[model samples]
Target: MVIKVERVLHMVGGGGETSYATNSRLQEKAIYRTKPILEIAVAEMYRTLLPEKMVVVDLGCSSGPNTFLVVSEVLGIVGDLCRRLEQKPPEIQFFLNDLPGNDFNNVFRSLERYEKKMEEENGGLLVPHYVVGVPGSFYGRLFPCNTVHFFHSSYCLTWLSQVPQGLGSEQGVPLNKGNFCIAENSPPQVVKAYQEQHRRDFSTFLKSRYVELSIGGGMVSTFLGIKSKHPANDELNYLYGLVAEALNAMVSQGIISENKVGTFNLPIYGASMQEVKSVIGVEGSFDVEKAESIWDPFDDSDNVLSGKNVASTLQAVMEPLISHHFGDAILHELFSLLADIITARHLLKDKCNYTVLNSNSLSSCHRRHGH
Candidate 1:
């Protein structure tokens, strides 16, 4: 019943209403907001190691306009620093990574345009930047040991490799039933199960990256998080909770089987700032330089259209996963349910449902590596 995330998770690519390339303005804004931190990371890197040749990798880099934005920020900073240092810009080996199912064709098609922009903006300092697509998962090694210099991953760490191992019973019944993710009403056991899965998966991720980063090499990561450690403080439940409610409504009218709702859960976790730092600390491979909660999703806007936006955005990001689990027949109904749920849920914008996390793990190896 478990779908390999590498085969199931990806944004809808291309120019369409549900396409991430078209509707990821919110994610693009989030990336823009993190530019300052990215600049700081790159600047600090130049202070110590200004190599004539450099290597940078972007993990979980889905295909879209947002995919290039982070690395572009890093590239700009590197270019500026080189000019100030009176040093020739480095020949960057940039890798854009994501699941194998990602629409890499779309990204590759956009590169000429991106390069043209970079050349004009940087005075041709980026003349020889070499970019390639790397398909894989960050939960495991994707590059050679000690090879990468700067690694950037944004808005993707919250996805678990699989559902928590112990959320089911001896009879094969779900222990954390009726919800797609952890929620306020979830039992303590359910909470612990999710926490443990995040810990293990994140630990694996750090270990792999630790082996890949050269000394003084660093990473800047942004992912979904929570305002507090307590499960009750979860702010992301409104969307999933509403999804569950909609299904329940259907079940009440015998529209869908109750067994379907009981058996499904999203392999995602919205960790608290504490959870993020704690894993970095426990993983023992990287040092956490700066870790903090950046912005509140609710505070980002009270747009009456947020529900629609949320549905469109998530559908673009998660349709593959949903369809893999429940089949495409339910997509229309499911998203309609989600849109209505967001429209009705009125927990003020600041209640902390969705949060952007900031973490700079300043930690490589070289033999081909990735993820």
Candidate 2:
């Protein structure tokens, strides 16, 4: 069955133990690491545009403290800049966009508290900002043409708009059995399908954003990427491989059928820097100012505890898609098995670190006609 990703794909909601809100420390860390880059991007945009009303968007802004963290960071930068210049701060129109299935209600409910916190912190100098929630896929346009001034996304673009097609045969046979991602054992066709999907989706993303951004506007996006051009050689493959192993264990216990495991593939890709740069070149909409790759490998000094942390993080991100495919009954058992496999077979054995790619200060090629 083809997955309707926008209908079901989302990080686990709320503040529960298995929720994305509770398990997103890894993503939070990435945000802080990318903060300096974000600072430069925002400052440059404001100095260049100096619009009385600035439009800023955070794509794939999932629910949690991390969501609010972005808001605070942007406000702080823009507000401080205006204060130092003794200029009137632009009214910020901030949009937090994600798939329709994201926990926007949770994000909405927390807004009042966030506002109170901001007031307590920034006081009289707070930038007049309006926060709006936009629900939709980023693969398509979300705003009017030439309206938005800046965009920021973190740990989101790795997800494809949908799972790649041709993973199964016309006769209903699953091709990439026993794995849900581009693994060492994944068929060549399976790998090719993922690559094509990433190229198509990412190109469409750039094209759409190019149309939406005003002249001189840009976006900063940070996401998972493979250090090696070969997809199978990366730690990202092994990380998902552990999850596949846990699913196979369930098949052994007759909890889920082999066909069920075989048919499921994650709608995510870890593109190499070359692959990303290639897409940007082909799209020809934005100019990349700076791109850097950071190593955020898991710490192995406490492999036992770190193993559990990895399991929890993956569970939060993967639970929605897995539960939709295999039923919610097996979630606890599945992640528990994953934790054990991670501790025994992987983290305890080899010190591996996942790679995070930060691409920032991507200003649109569009500029004022005479400039």
Candidate 3:
């Protein structure tokens, strides 16, 4: 099995135009869209029990402004809710997790200012939560048993730990063919290979969390996904189609070789609601409480930023992966085309065909039943 794990696919680790920090407004919007769920989780936890000490884990917490956004929200919620109930807020131990290649420096640097901001906003009434960075893959155990109480992640699960295996020929050659992700024209075998990898990774994710979450603890996660099960329903198919077409046009102009497209496969799969439900149902550790596709990840409601928001957002995280595969030479050309495509689509219609998912932001929380 051949699998490629390019470092860039992890995330853009800075505040540049193509960096995760600059382009994560979509994720923020997604987070806000899921506010009702967060409120329920916070309310439930504090209502039933408020431990003197508690733990919260943020997985796939990349180096960006959004890095601590959810953590801050969780802290704020815990503090406010406890105060309302006349209970002391739990002493929080916050853990930020990501692959080893992620930029922890940028994250650490922002901590002091973020803390100051939190302190100022809460009128010095905020609980001081301890934060630690844990670097590793969440597809496996990331902490000691019974350590975390509440877990959160967003905009990261679509990434497989490695490229899907078995997309090669008997001769050990790549069969995905000139595409970096699922396409409308992609072969069934290619699609199957990607789907299998998502199911395996998602199941591993659930089992690992089951081990780490405390009794009655839960998780909140989000992914960029859709509700349709058909492989063609993938939004990446459309977005990357814009990219693949541009690359092909360049191929005809002889800017690059035709063979480049044959080996590149986007190591991403936004799980459909059906796909996620199947795994959660099978894993049996976490119950899928709400698998609703709330809002479009690309809801440019009033054409404000128009489509630049979409392009910049995708560019920040994708530049590394796309440039890694195609070299940085053609990126400017590639995304410019993508921006135009997004703008035209946004202006012409109020609703998008593909639902932008950032689910549980994977916000699925499983109560520890039968534990």
Q: Give the whole-model CA lDDT for all candidates, comma-separated.
A: 0.77, 0.88, 0.74
Error of 3 at 268 (Å): 0.4
* Candidate 1 lDDT for residue 192: 91
Model 2 pairs whose backbones collide: 297-353
Those runs of model 2 whose alpha carbons end farther than 4 Å from true positions after fitting are 170-173, 299-301, 367-371
Tens-digit per-residue lDDT, 165-224, candidate 2? 888754666678788989998889999999999999999999899889888787899978
The candidate that achieves the highest lDDT relative to the unseen native structure: 2
* TM-score against native, each model: 0.91, 0.96, 0.89
Residues 229-296, candidate 1: write the lDDT tens digits.
Answer: 68556666555666677777777878677777777777888888888888887766777777767654
Kindly report which residue stretches of model 3 are placed more than 4 angstroms away from their true locations once superposed: 1-3, 169-174, 234-236, 297-305, 344-371
What would the per-residue lDDT of candidate 3 be over residues 1-371, giving only the tens digit for each residue?
12356345567776777788877777777777776777777567556557888898888888877888887888888887877888877788999999887889999999999888888987884776898999888989999997787888776788897888766653655465556678776678888988999999999988898888777676677777866667666564676676677677778888777767666667788787778777888887777655577546464554635566677777877777767777899888777766777777643554344455433422234342432
Model 2 poorest ten-residue lDDT run: 362-371
* TM-score ranking, best first: 2, 1, 3
RMSD to the hidden true structure, all candidates: 3.7, 1.7, 3.2
Instruction: Report the number of the highest-TM-score candidate.
Output: 2
Q: How well does candidate 1 score on lDDT at residue 208? A: 89
